[model samples]
Structures are given as structure tokens and as C-alpha cells.
Target: MLVELVGQSGRDLDNVSANPARLVNVYAERTTEGERVLKSVLGMDRHTQLDGVFVRAMGRVDGVTYAVCGGHLWRINLHGSANDLGAVDTGRATLCGNNGYVCVQAGTRYFVYDPDADTITEPAAGAFSDIGSVEFFGNYTVITEAGGRRFQWSALADPTDLPGLNFSTADGKDDNLLRGLAMDGRLYLFKQESTELWYNTGEAGADAMARVAGGVWDIGLLSRDMLCQFEGGAFIVGSDNRAHLVSSGGFQPVSIPPVETAIKIDRPQACLTYSDEGHTFCAIIFKDSPAWVYDLSMNEWHERAEGVNLGPWNVAASCKIGKEWAVGRNNGEISILRRTNADGSTPLVREITSRTLRMDGQRTILREFEVFPRQGFSAGTMNLHISRDGGSTWTPPKPKPIGGQGEYGRRVLWRNLGQARAINAKLRWTEPRDICLSTQARIVT
Candidate 1:
């Protein structure tokens, strides 16, 4: 957490308070790209791998943290340091590059994260479903329309225009489908059809993009069913069903499992890269399930996802990066993964403590007050009854300023000042609870 001091009304502070949020040191395994995610979650038992995200970080995922269990934007860091216009939890995240961008979903809200100076400012929402997949295709940033029908982001003409898909309109269907988009520096949208559409991020709408040639299926083993990129090019994943390949050349059928044997993959992302030592693969998280990594090089399947003393299914999955990676379950633990030497040998997963909520609503003044009716006043209503000046004059209570904070102690918010009597008053209160008052404390002013 960064610390700073502001002049109170233009004058220097007599002595700036030293109490501030702490930034614990942490580590995360370096991806093939050599990016180190914050792995502050050390020794936090386990809460089960339940939910994750991959977005540029702007740090500050504070505010009403969106990380509540079953919470959507729990670990979404599609931002940087600037307190986004609303509530975006991103800090110290690495996106592709200046041209490359990241997308995220916090609850029903979806936006992008730019890593320049720590700022988030897009408030694009109002969709049927949460944003599913976001990719920077050749010339545009293409995003799946989320749960329901969605027009292309281009429709809004925001600089972050998302590419349009051929599969669905604003009416989404069978879209449990995922999108693999990247710019060869050119516009490209890859779905199953193999007919790769070349799109322009520069253009305003879907009609602007044009489908280029079909070299995408030309290279090695690849199919629309699964596509993953390695050092050279992308490879279509080995399927539990009939297999096929997509390369720089075109499409070619390969040998593998039959279509009927295909199982609903809990892993939503495309496994792009992996390491032999730890047998861990890079894959995007889907349905909050553990990330799947096949040790093809070592003939093993390893799970680098987060887990805890809680139920494995507590959250759907835990294979994710960023701040919210380890936040979930009864223990409320958080964890980040780190590489041992390099080859990913049993990637070290550690827990990080959450920043204590340093500041809170002002300590309830927990004050008690007592009062009594002047010499002759009775029980019912009394006109001008009591006064600070020895009861020389009676002053009625001002109903407007009542109920603010801890007014005369009855936990002010709970006290019915309007129904109070014009007599003396007495009130008492405690912490973590409300205030109480007796007949003696019931007063008008």
C-alpha cells in the first residue's frame, strides 16, 4: 500500500499520523513472460481453489471488496493504481503491452485495465450476463457478450471497442462458447468454424472487419475445439473427442477420442504455456474451478490452483492470479504461487494476510446523558419546560437535528427523539452493539 499525506486546508500537518496500511512482500511464479504476481498469501491454511481472474493490476482492490464468496469480480484486476471511477480492484498487474489490454468482471460490472499510472475509469455495464471472454484480436479487443445477448462493444464507440462475433447477436446462445482472440498485429477472431475473420479495432462496428485467408488451420495439430499458443505458433488441444489441428497453413483432421467421449471441461481458459519441472500449464480459469495443467512433457497432471482447509468445492475453482486469488472459504485465506528454481518444481503456494481494516466508522462516542424535569413539570407534554439557564426559560427540542450519530447516547440512530418527553434524559451504550436508554433519559431537547 502506498502512503501519502495531504495538507489539511493548505497548512502542513503538525505531525502526520504514522499509522498506514502495510504492503507485505510476496511472490508469484514467473510466467513464461516473466511476470511476477503478488504471492502474499503465505501459510494461510487453505480455503479451496474457488474463483480467479487474469487482468492488469492497478492494486487497490479495496472499497466494498467484490470478493465475497460466489462474488463474480472477486479477483478481477483489469486496472492499475488509480481508484477507478467506481470500484475496481486492480493494482500491480501486468497486461500484454501498451497495445495489448485486459478485461474484467466485478459483479455485473465489466471493464478494462490499463497499466500506465494506476487508474480505472470505464463504467460499462448493463448487460444480461457477466463478461465471459476478452481478447485483443488482430485490430480490435473482442469480448464475449457475457450472460445474455450483447451487441459488440463497438456499438458504443468507446476506444475499447470489442470485436463482434458471428455466432450470436444481442441474443446469446450455446455461447457457453469461448473466444480466442489476438492480433497478429492484424484483426482476427477464432471460433470453431475455421473461417478466421479479420477485424479492425480501428473500425466502429462488426461490419467493418473482413475475413482474411485461412492459414490459421495450416500449421500443426489444431482444431476449433481447442487452441493454445506456444513459443512458435498455436496448437489445437488434444481432444477427448475426434481430433483436428489448426496451424499457420489450414485445417487437418487428427486421430483421437470420439466426439461422444468429450466431457464438459471445468477449465474454461486455453492452456497456453507450461513448465516441465512442476508440470504446470498456463490456462485461464472457468466456472471457478481448479486450473488444469497436463505434464505432457513429464506425463503428469498437476493443479497449481489455490486450496485450503475448507471444502474443495467451496468455490468452483482456485487457479487464478492477483489479489483475490486466495480469498474465500471460512478461513478467509489468500495465496499466491511461486516457482522453486525455474522449471516449476512443485510451485510454491504461499498465503498472505489481508490488510487489517485500519480505519473504521468513528468510535461510537458511547456517551450517556441524564436529565430531569424542572421542579414542577409533569409526565405528559410540557410547553417551555427546561433550560440550560437554571430553567428560567423553557425550550422545545429541535426535531430536525435529532437522530444524528449518537445523539444523547440512545445510539442516536435508534432513539425516537420525536416521541421523547420534555423531561430529563439518561442514555448508555457499548461497543459492537447499540445504545440503551431508560425513562430518566427521555427528553425533548
Candidate 2:
């Protein structure tokens, strides 16, 4: 499950997890006061899906939690609730308000969006081919791709002109598949083709892998080196053709076992993600099915729970938040899992019922729907609510105006608000009095 977003464009995290939990813990940042708080949950419900193997995050726009999957040249932000924020469609990528463009693949292209007005524009950018992934670091956006080609986006360039990237990694040739990057503040690169893993010194044909483990091709980037999972060394491959950390750092080597028990591989490339508690998670293919969570501290591999299986996904994206993880499949299946127990054995998996109801690139066409009565509108006020789960429930939250002033409804701000899948509520205000209740129905997951 690829959870977090990758690439040079779109959104990333500002701070790392500060608090730790016995089973799992997460930090709650108070946007109103700008303070990040921490909390620990007893056990996760098996009914809720909270698994993410890619690099998605539990984000908040105006205190709303969202599930986002990002990769490729530029990261994508799925607005609204986790259930509704579908995968960032490749060709369906649209532009929204302020005429600001999303610089992907390290500034190779800029996809501009005007959400308020509902429009998407791709500014001609020559940076596309060379760009891999982009993300906003402190002041600049960091970009990387399968080759680990790193760069930054510059605003000085013409809006139509490609963003000037500031950095480069000549060592792009070091890793063949470019499995992992920047683990423990140091970039970890690996190419399954290599006989000896090499490290990148910013040059080609360098030692891209560390002597971390044997028969290793998968790598995950944790906050710092102190955090990360090792297969002690048992690893697995998922149906998505991605790799997972099935076991922890210390495991007795077992024979390849039977070809039936384990799956075969040609270029067995996989990815890993972390739980909100920083627990390492790996999803790999096993006997054709993509069985995941090989080594969750709860049960030792041999004695631990076998965990769940991910259906076929040509390209799967994942990310983690506390004990929860999310897996977004290309087939339009998003399985959210929570670590019910300390170990990965028992997990709470839930399929999202909500899908993309409507996506209008043109605003006038969207506003055409009169704000008046309809078949679904016999009650007081009906706010359109989206879910990360499979459209099972709906709750509209209070609307926070931009700049804290109740005047204008900024597009960028609403777009950002939509990122919080849990809190991003679509208000159905038949009367002004009903607006306050919107926040009361926010989904905390």
C-alpha cells in the first residue's frame, strides 16, 4: 500500500511524529493554536481500513483528515474524505484557482488549478521528461523519480515556463529501479540488478545499497535512521508487484520454501510504509495473492498472524498514520487497515464505499445545480459528505472562512480543506442556522 505522496509537486508533511505509543500513537496538531498534540489508542477496530504502503498522509485542511496518494513526477492530493478522494487520475489531473500550477517531475510540467472556479490548465513546461517526483521541503519543492533524479521548483520562472530546478543527483545511474531514497537523512538506493548493493555519492555506477540485508530490493524512507523496518530478514512481494517488510530485523533464515508458498519473481520490486507509530509495513506477493504485514511485532513471523491480502493492483499507493494504513489500488479499491493489536496479525480492514461522485473542470457547469430542493433534500440542510470508507456514512462539518474572516471563499483554501478527508465537509445549508452543525458531524478517523 503506497500511502504518502512522492515526487516534486503537491503537499508533504511539515513535522515528524514526536510522541510514541506502546501499540500505536499519533500526533494531533491544533490548527487554531498551531500546536501539535499527541494521543494513543488502545486497539484499532478491524472494521476500519487504515493501511497505506505508498506514502499517503492523514492531513487536515481546516482540521479535517484526508487520505492522499502521491507519486510519479508530481505528488497528487485527493481532496474531500478518504472515501471520496480517489487516486490522482493521470489524464484526469485538473488545475484549480489562483492560476497556481502544480509543478510535477521536478518542475518538468506545471498543472495549474482553480478549484473555486473549477478549471485545470497544464502550462507548457519542458521539465516533464527529466522530472521524476516533487514535494515542498521547507522553502522549496524536492523532486525525485525512479532514477533518483533530484531537483527543486523555482517560482521565478514564467508561469508558462518550466520551473527552474535547483538540485541534481548525477548518481541517478547508481540504482536501477531506484527503490528507496532518503532514509535516516541519508538517501538509500538499490537496484536488484546489482550483484553488490552500492551507495550513491551523487555519481553513477556507485554502491547504491547498504549491507542492510540479503536478497533485499525493497527499502522504506523513515523520518530518521532510528526508525525503519528490517526483514530480520524476511520480505514479501505484493500483487501490486511491490515489496513489503514481512518480518522484523532478526529472523532465522529459512529456505526459499516451496515455490507455492512463496511467489516467483523476475524483477520483484516492492515498497514499504510506516504506521502512525512508525511501525514498518511491507506488502508483497505470496502464492499469487499480495499478502501483506509479514512482520508485525505482535506475532513473530512463524507464530504471528498471516495478515490480509491485497487484490491485483497494477500500481498501488500507500501511506501510514499512527496504527492506520491505506492501500489505493489502480482497480479503484482502497483498503484502509488499522493495527488492532500490537503486531500486524489482527488488522481492521474496511473498503471505502464512496467514490468520485462528480468532478467538474468547469465551475459554471457545477454551479448550474440550483441550491434549492431536490429528491435527497427533504430535511433541514443537507451537506454533501464524502468518506474514505466505501460511502457508508456522511457527516458535514462547520465551514471555516478563509483568513478567519467570514467574507470570501478562497479556492486554494477550500482545496486545501478538501485534503482533510475526515473534516472536509460539503455543507448543504438550506438555512444559515444549520451551518454551525456542520462541524459537529466531522469524522474523526
Runs in model 2 lying further than 4 Å from the true structure: 1-130, 135-138, 145-162, 165-167, 172-180, 186-263, 266-280, 285-287, 296-315, 320-323, 338-445
Q: Per-residue lDDT of 1-445 in model 2, one digit per residue for the tens?
A: 1111111011111211111000111112123564322222212222233233332222222222333334222222333123333233232111211223333221223443323344444554433343343333222223334344333333432233335333344342344332233323233333333211223233221122223435343332211111123424324333223333333332122212221133343222233333444444443322233333322432212101123322332324444333345544433334444434221233312111111222332212121111112122122333343332223344454333222234233221222223322221233222211111101121211
What lDDT is reached at residue 418 by model 1?
A: 26
Candidate 1 regions with alpha-carbon error over 4 angstroms: 1-102, 105-109, 113-119, 122-131, 147-177, 183-196, 199-208, 213-273, 276-292, 295-336, 339-445
For each candidate, the alpha-carbon lDDT, in order, equals 0.30, 0.29
With candidate 2 superimposed using the best TM-score fit, by how many Å does residue 51's alpha carbon deviate from the native? 20
**TM-score for each predicted model, relative to the true structure:** 0.37, 0.36
lDDT of 1 by residue, 1-445 (tens): 2212110111111211221111111222334764322222122233233233332221222222223222223333323111223344432111121152334443334565444434444544433335544444443334544333332443332424433332234211122223444534443334333233343535444454444544333122122225444433443443332233344434444322211122143434333342333333333323344433332333222233343311122221232333223222322233333322111122222212111122233322212222221222111211112222222233443221123332333222223322221222111111111111111231222
> Which candidate wins on TM-score?
1
Q: Whose lDDT is greatest here?
A: 1
TM-score of 1: 0.37
